[model samples]
Target chain A: MTDTSLIDTSPQGSTRRSWTFTIGAIVVGLHLVIGLSTLFWTPYDPTAMSGGRLEMPSLAHVAGTDRLGRDLFTLIMIGSRIALIVGTGAIVIGGLIGIAIGLLAAFASRTLDDMLAAGLDILIAFPTLLLAMLIVASSDGASLWTAIVAIGIANSAIVARLTRILAKRVLRMDYITASRISGTSWIGVVAIHILPNIWPTLLVNLALQFGLAVIAEASLSYLGLGTPPPNASWGRLLQEAQGTVYTAPLGAIAPGIALVSLVIGVNLLADGLRDIADPTRRRRR
Target chain B: MSPLLGIESLTIQAGGKPLVSNVSFSVAPGERLGLIGESGSGKSLTALASIGLLPDGLQASGSVLLDGRQVVGARDRDLVPLRGTVAAVVFQEPLTALDPLMTIGRQVGIAVRRRAKRDGHPTDSITVMGEVLDLLDQVSLPQPQRIAEAWPHEVSGGQRQRAAIAMALACKPKLLIADEPTTALDVTTQAEILKLLGQLVRERNMALLFISHDLPVVAGAVDRVVVLRHGSIVEQGPVATVFGQPSHEYTQSLVAAARAFDDALEIAP
Candidate 1:
């Protein structure tokens, strides 16, 4: 047998980290810095009609101005913050609910497990956007938290399905039996063995879910069922800029660029994380 | 002495079809019993049912008494206390038997801590680690400290099996059910693991239910043998009586095959 100890003694060996991870991290990091900076400072007030309307990119206004004369750059920066908030919030809510349901399904009695599996399949098959729209339309109309809750609930079905499949696979392994035979409780088994083994894959899936959540939030905002006025959501900016696109394209283009970059960054990060988290993939490289 | 493990007419069914039909066996305290069966013979299922660890969709009927506790139809919570304390199992594949994400030491430490808590001894991290190393040493693993820190993939198959044995030993179980523990190892490693298992069982006075398909291996480890075919017990007797003068046709064929293989090995240039 090949002795892996010599080469793979350290968990975080030098060759394990790849350039894909580096680039993705940098891109995500840049967005995070720009987004977080908005909490303390922005060059121009994002909500104020403080510049010449429909101006092109120039020294006075970096990304130019919107039809309402708000600083496009400031709005884009705030959009980053909103995107991050919605993504993080949605994942947290989705992950907790999904993981709990998935684990319950995994450890549940045969009849209950089947019922949960069928329920989850139906939920997964339903369109996420349509579900989000329904949720937004039903209760306390679209604010930031409402949009977050809607997207989060929409995201949970997919997360639950993935978690269920992954958890079941982990559960089938002999170690789980060994754990139980070792007197570890079911809760302890989940906490110690099942979760730790499945988290890397789950984490990669959650990162992709984070990207979807951002896009879903943007879509909701565009439909006017998301974060309302003065918040300057990228989708809201796109909606307002749709009419003035011919005269001034930057208004539409700036927010679109911000949204695309963040999503792409997240996707790349997920891809890189999968490569890093899986030792087989790392070894192959 | 009463049997540490007693299975009387155990029947395991999946999807209303019986997989193991009316199987019966008993293992007395400190006795070594070999369960001999080929793949799909339900030996593993019988072992699992003995501890109430049978997979979902497979229903077990009849009595499985482990240390006087009813394992058949027993609630998981009720079985939890009995497992690890009464009996601990070392599975066939050592690599998959251990948690890949955890270091060998930590996994063994969990068992050690559980045993300590059950015995109402000190369960602090330092004491647990100390006991973990002790178990590793008891398994005769070279450089116990290094083995403790190693991941499952980092070690050889034998070492991994040794570590798995260490984990099983950590619980200080009265009965050690080895379900083909040495089957996944190389020929040399298999012999070493079997030797280690025999020595440990002897040293700790733990009853051993050694399950395997290899006739010679089972004959060497166990005093008595239970031959199973297609989930049914064909014949069972003292290892010498059964292997020397087989009564059942299946057992006779098995003995013949083992003898043929042994002769082939002896004649090899």
Candidate 2:
């Protein structure tokens, strides 16, 4: 048996501050800062067509103006706000409902567990984008919150499935049986024993889901089922910039870069969290 | 007085097939009963049945009485209060018995709080902390304070086993079902754990159901021995009578093997 002193505790506590995690945090943080800042100030009004069309990058117009004569920088900044809202909103809706369903399935009787598993399998078989489109189509018109809700519902099935698998694995451990025999309530068992053991993996999955959420929102907007006109969605920006790409490529390039970078940042954050969650891996590193 | 624990023809079935059939035994308060059986001899199943923790898909048909209360067919709601107070269990694997994410103190504190709640006593942090420390000390762990704060993975195998026992003793249960509690420890650690269990049981006058596959291991710790093979009791008597003059062929063979194991250990060093 390995000596108790040989087991290091710092890896779990310190890995959150590691370089990969720090960089990820910064990337996500900058988008949040830009998103929130846009609520108060922007160089030019994003919705107002009060600038020269297809203007080049200048001191006054950092990213220049779009073909609609709206400030490109202002549009990009507000687009960041839309991305953050949809990403976080979808994640919250999906993660909560998914984890709850998964936990219920895990603790339920064998027949019920099988039923839930079958239902989740059917839900997963449908492509998330197609499911979101069907949901959005049900509404009279496209809107930001509607799109977020649709994407969230689509994301829930995947999250629920993952939670069930991970939670079932934890449930098999002897500690769970011991906890039950110790008279811990079912809720207490999940909170104190099951959750802590399964959180690391669930967290990583949630992070990846967050990244997928951002992309899903962007895709919806690009397909005209997302945030409607007057709101500057990055996907809308991509769509608007496509026509004028030959003349003003930066308009398209800026939102594209933001979308990719934010998703990359979230993925990187998930990787760092995985390392911290498993101390043996952190120690090996 | 009624026995602290009584098993009247306890039978366990899986998928309509009998796995353990009509196994009967009883342990008076403060008496140590050793259940000797091989892996598939239904020893562990009997122990689980005693506490109503049979695995999913296995139906138990029998009466398990603890202090004259029927536990075998009791609902989980009724069993909750009984567990950790009337009776508690220590599983075979110490490594997985204790919650890895929790401190030893916190884990033991849970059992303490549960018992206090059952007795209609309000529990404060100070009382819980004091009780946790006391339980650790009772298990003869080194530096109760240090052990209380340590995680299960941060302790030695012997220490972990001791902590598990402490948790089981937290409720001051009248019956302690130790199911191969020391099977995973080193030879020396095993002996220490067995001794600790024996001393605690004797001091508290708790009924002990010690289940193990090793016959010699049972001999030192129990007053009576029940030998099982293929889910039926082959022979059961006082430890001296069962060991000195076995009546069943299976019991005789088991005794022979146990004696051989002891001889091998003696000649090794």
On lDDT, the candidate that comes out on top is 1
Candidate 2 C-alpha lDDT tens digits along B1-269: 78988999999999989999999999998889999988999999888888788888999998899778898778988887677777888888887888776778988898888888778877898988998899999999878887887767767888888888888888788989999988999889999999999999999999899999877789999999999999999999999999999999998898898889879999997
Query: lDDT of model 2 at residue B195?
Result: 93
Q: Which runs of model 2 end up more than 4 angstroms from their true locations?
A: A1-6, A9-17, A270-285, B120-122, B267-269
- The candidate that wins on DockQ is 1
- Model 2, residue A39: displacement in angstroms? 2.3
Cα lDDT tens digits for candidate 1, A55-108: 888898899998988889999999999999999999999999999898898888
DockQ of each: 0.56, 0.46
How far residue A63's Cα lies from its native spot in candidate 1, in Å, is 1.2
Restricting to chain A, the TM-score for each candidate equals 0.92, 0.92
Docking class of predicted structure 2: acceptable
- lDDT by residue (B1-269, candidate 1, tens digit) is 77999999999999899999999999999999999988999999999999999988899999999999999998999999999999999999877898888788999998998888888999999999999998899888877888787667777888888898898898889999999998888999899999999999999999999999999999999999999999899999999999999999999999999999989999999
